[model samples]
Target chain A: MPYINIQITREGASREQKAQLIRGATDLVVQVLGKNPATTFVVIEEVDTDHWGIAGETVTVLRERARQGGAQ
Target chain B: MPYINIQITREGASREQKAQLIRGATDLVVQVLGKNPATTFVVIEEVDTDHWGIAGETVTVLRERARQGGAQ
Candidate 1:
């Protein structure tokens, strides 16, 4: 099983929105990967803007220049 | 780079313990995977006893049967 890890920046998500994102993302993995939801473990991480970085840039730093809010 | 994903329940962890778990787990990935911390993205998810499951069982469900706790 190719363990897929994801940390989606929950910047503008409402409580419901966050929940949907987590559930949907996990479900997507289950559907695409054809893995059991039980074995297909999913972790929903609510990352801080400052803590999470990519390509040597923090999510917050990227967000300032981002035209659109969400990307992956 | 194999994207290693983990869902560990913070059942018996203290505040400091939790931070260490996140830091240490991430660091271990960095060390073992030989991935740049910048590119070596790590997501430390504090799972609930109910939500996080493994092998068709919740972390809590397994913990009851655990010998000394902390395995992987």
Candidate 2:
């Protein structure tokens, strides 16, 4: 069984969107690796902005800075 | 930055348990790879038993069979 995990910023997706992601990811794995869809697992996690960081700044801070037109 | 995603069967852990897992995973990545904790991301996803399978059987089915003492 192949397990796929997807992470996105908090409140970034709707339930329907997440379902689509799970289905698409599973289909891709099955197409490429010949894995059984019934045996494949897909997990989607929504992370709080403060708990996710890039370039040493949390996503919360990055979004705030971007809103104010701050330099990247 | 190192990103870690942890998956577990749904309803199998508590909030505190997940926090511990996040901290431990982040610390291990930092210690082994010299990754910065500020930029490290950890996401934990709890998948429904129906969504997780092994050996062509869903975890829900497996648990049910085990409860009845059925052959694996």
Candidate 3:
């Protein structure tokens, strides 16, 4: 069984969005890896801004940059 | 890359314990499937008692019963 764990840096994703993400991710794994969807498990972890750091910048900082269309 | 997602019904396991569990679990997976540990990603989700329900009982209830030596 292949288990795929995805960490979403932003929390507060609704249940419906979560469901779609799970399905889409599972499908992607199946298509790319040819793994059986039944035995493969997909786990999603909603992360807070404090839990993630990229390039010495926090998620909050990244979001701010994105909002200002910095290097999109 | 094989990702192993582990869901623990009870939360609050220390970092050391989590490390041990992840190592042991990865070893088990390697022993059983001959997979490389380096490429295997192990993610552990510590579930709150309220998030888990088993056999009409919550994890809290199960822990309470287990403490009294109900079952081994």
Candidate 4:
């Protein structure tokens, strides 16, 4: 069984979008790795911006900085 | 950089537990794979029972069956 985990910031993604992600990920693995869809597992994880870090800074801080920079 | 994602059913885990998971996973990667903890990412994903499946049945259904079997 092949397990694929997709991590994204907790932006407001709809259930339909999540479903599409699950389907697309499964399809890709099946196509590229010849994995069986029945046994393949695709999980979508929505992480809070505060908990997700990048380059030693959390996404919350990074996004705020970007917004301020854009307004300047 | 090493990325580790841990998936568990949405069973009301506390923030402390999640933190422990993150720390433990990062330490494991550093000790075993010799990855830098600073660049190591650990994400904990809590999934709904309905969305997780095994043997063609969702975890929701499986847990219910287990409870019923225990009562009988």
Candidate 5:
């Protein structure tokens, strides 16, 4: 069984979008790797802005800086 | 930051169980990979038995067979 996990910054993702992602990911794995769709699993995780970071700065801080037009 | 995703066959996992899993996984990643817990993300996904399969048999079928004492 092939398991695919998708992580995104906490925001709003409609249920339909999640369904599309799951379907597309499963199809891609089946097409590329010949995995069975019945056994393939797709999971989506939403990471909180405070818990997600890049360049050693949490997303919360980065967003705030961006909003204030501060230097990167 | 390290992201950990755990997949399990859905049955009955309490919120407390999931919390412990998240905490333990984060700690393990920090100790082994030296990842920062503040940015580390741990997510758990529960897959339906029908959606999880091994050896071409779905977990649902396997469980039913086991309950009936059938050959694996």
Candidate 6:
């Protein structure tokens, strides 16, 4: 069984989107890795922007900076 | 760099417990895999019982059956 974990920032994605992601991930694993869809597991994790980090800065700060730069 | 994803049923885990899991996972990767803690990513996902499946049955149904068996 192959386990896939998809992490994304908690930006209010709908349940339908999550279901689509789960289906897409499982399909990819089955197609590329030749895994059985029945045994494959796909987990979707939504992390808060404040908790997800990039380059020693959190996504919250990074997004804010990007917004400011774009506005300037 | 190592990425660790821990999946568990949504059973009302506290923030401290999640933090402990993240720290413990990071430490394990550093010790066992000799991975850089800075580059290591640990994500904890709490899934609804209705979503997680085993033996073609969801955890919600499985737990209910177990509880019924225990009561009999």
CA displacement after TM-score superposition, residue A23 of candidate 5 (Å): 17
Q: Write the per-residue lDDT of candidate 2 for residues A1-72, one digit (tens) a residue.
A: 999988788956888999999999999999999999999999986887655545444566668988899776
- Which candidate leads the pack in DockQ? 1
| Candidate 3: Cα lDDT at B61 | 55
lDDT of 3 by residue, B1-72 (tens): 578887976667899999998899889879999999989889987855533334323455558889989884
Displacement of residue A29 (Cα, Å) in model 5 is: 20
Per-model TM-score on C-alpha atoms: 0.42, 0.55, 0.48, 0.55, 0.54, 0.55
lDDT of 4 by residue, A27-68 (tens): 998999898999999888789765565433455666899888
Model 3 segments more than 4 A misplaced: A65-72, B1-6, B9-44, B47-72
**Candidate 2 has what TM-score?**
0.55
RMSD of 2: 8.8
As for candidate 3, its clashing pairs are none
Error of 6 at A61 (Å): 0.8
Tens digits of per-residue lDDT, candidate 3, A1-72, equal 566666777657765565565667667767888877766655566678877899998888887888998774
DockQ, prediction 2: 0.13
Model 6 ranges with Cα > 4 A deviation: B1-6, B11-45, B49-72
- DockQ of candidate 5 against the true complex: 0.06
- Local accuracy by lDDT, each model: 0.60, 0.79, 0.70, 0.78, 0.78, 0.78
lDDT of 5 by residue, A1-72 (tens): 899988887778899999999999999999999999999999998766654444344566668998899776
Query: Residue by residue across B1-72, what tens digits does model 4's lDDT show?
Result: 987767899878876666666767777878998888778776666789999999999999989998887642
Instruction: In model 1, state the lDDT of residue A1.
Output: 40
* Candidate 4 Cα outliers beyond 4 Å, as residue runs: A1-8, A11-45, A49-72
Chain A alone, model 1, TM-score? 0.50
**Candidate 3 lDDT:** 0.70
Q: What does fnat come to for each candidate?
A: 0.20, 0.18, 0.00, 0.04, 0.02, 0.02
Rank candidates by TM-score, best first. Answer: 6, 4, 2, 5, 3, 1
TM-score of chain A as modeled in candidate 4:
0.88
